[model samples]
Target: MSDKKDPSVWQGFKAFLMRGNVVDLAVAVVVGAAFTNIVNAVVKGMISPVIGAIGTKNLDHYDSCLSATCQGDQGIQIMWGSVLGATLQFLITAAVVYFLMVLPMAKFLARQEARKKAREGTEAAVELTELEVLKEIRDELVARRRSEYGER
Candidate 1:
């Protein structure tokens, strides 16, 4: 048999942990966790209270009894208010992320792209003019050389 040894598990684990994507994922997870708290707070504190002013303060308490014996958890109860609250939270989070982050980033990127295109346009015009001048000079030199040579 050959004398080559297999790599240890620790080396494999270390390589996995040292990967750039893994580090980025770890940072994203941490930031997501922190962001979750903020979103939850906004949903619970602001949205929930405003909605609760029209009904029960706790969305979990709002449910419909589908069966006749719904008293004391004895029948089928549809917790529609909880679902509505969850949906509202999702919408609010989406709107916040969109309006605050995504929209602004898109606008900034568009502005940057426009500036880049403008620069490229200006540079292209200058380059085209420079090329035309070089071609003119070449043609003029060739014409002068041909006239001198032809005359000789």
Candidate 2:
């Protein structure tokens, strides 16, 4: 029998979980879910009141009646308030995500890349300096060797 052994499914699954993208996505999902509550609260407790000043206090209360009498199927009522509430929620969520998580992370990554590039440039400069020093030492050695041989 061959001594080689194939990787188990568990090992493969573990590797998948360890990948950067997978871990980042998992973390984003958890944070996003948690952030959802804050967005909802902001829209409900803050924005809704401002909107209420202009219109109805609650979006659920804003509806249109299709029939002459809107009493339990006597007339058809189009509940547009719920749609407005959903739209408001969506906007709040998008704004919070962009400002808090995405923007800061992008700026941080840009800073890290800049630092890495600067370090690489410094390393290159040091290598060039080392090369110049070595060349100068080699030239001095050749000069000494030639002078001694000429005297002999």
Candidate 3:
């Protein structure tokens, strides 16, 4: 009975895509993807070399074969070294992101929030002072009016 037409599905989809959180999540995904390479490079270049100095050059090579012979996964073989390498890589990535990005961002946000609260407090004080001044002026005007009228 209404003249208005219902919105199209594509319009709704477009609205969802254009939302702030969706855009932020997309940006985060892209930045995370780009940052992954840097973490990987650090692990491969710096951490790997340090580990290599103490042990084998390649961490992947430090595995144990459950079977008598490890012929290309033909027998049961536990690749604990690969697991260790992966774990190390994850730890390095987490540490780099935590120290470089997360910690700094958290500190910055806290400082910003503190500044915002301080500003709000000052604004409230100023507003209260202005209200008090206005009330005093109103009281003075009323008193002068009453005195002049009482004389008549």
True-vs-predicted CA distance for residue 95, candidate 1, Å: 0.7
Model 3, C-alpha of 124: deviation from truth (Å) = 1.4
Give lDDT: candidate 1, residue 129: 100
Model 1 TM-score (2 dp):
0.84
Query: Per-residue lDDT of 1-152 in model 3, one digit per residue for the tens?
Result: 23343456667888999999999999999999988898888888988899899998578888888888889858887888889989988888799889999999999999999999999999999999999999999999999999999999
Q: Please give the ranking of all candidate structures by lDDT, highest first, separated by commas.
A: 2, 3, 1
Query: What does each candidate score in C-alpha RMSD?
Result: 2.9, 4.5, 4.0
- Which 10 consecutive positions of candidate 1 have the poorest summed lDDT? 1-10
Q: Runs in model 3 with CA error above 4 Å? A: 1-7, 65-75, 138-152
Q: Which ranges in model 2 have alpha carbons more than 4 Å from their true place?
A: 1-7, 60-81, 145-152
The TM-score-based order of candidates, best leading, equals 1, 3, 2
The clash count for each model shown is 0, 0, 0
Global lDDT of each model? 0.88, 0.89, 0.89
Give a tens-digit lDDT track for model 1, residues 106-136: 9999999999999999999999999999999
Tell me the tens digit of each residue's lDDT in model 2 across 16-129.
999999999999899888888888888889988998999977999889998889987678999999999999899878887789878999999999999999999999999999
Q: After superposition, how far is residue 20 of candidate 3 from its true place, in Å?
A: 1.6
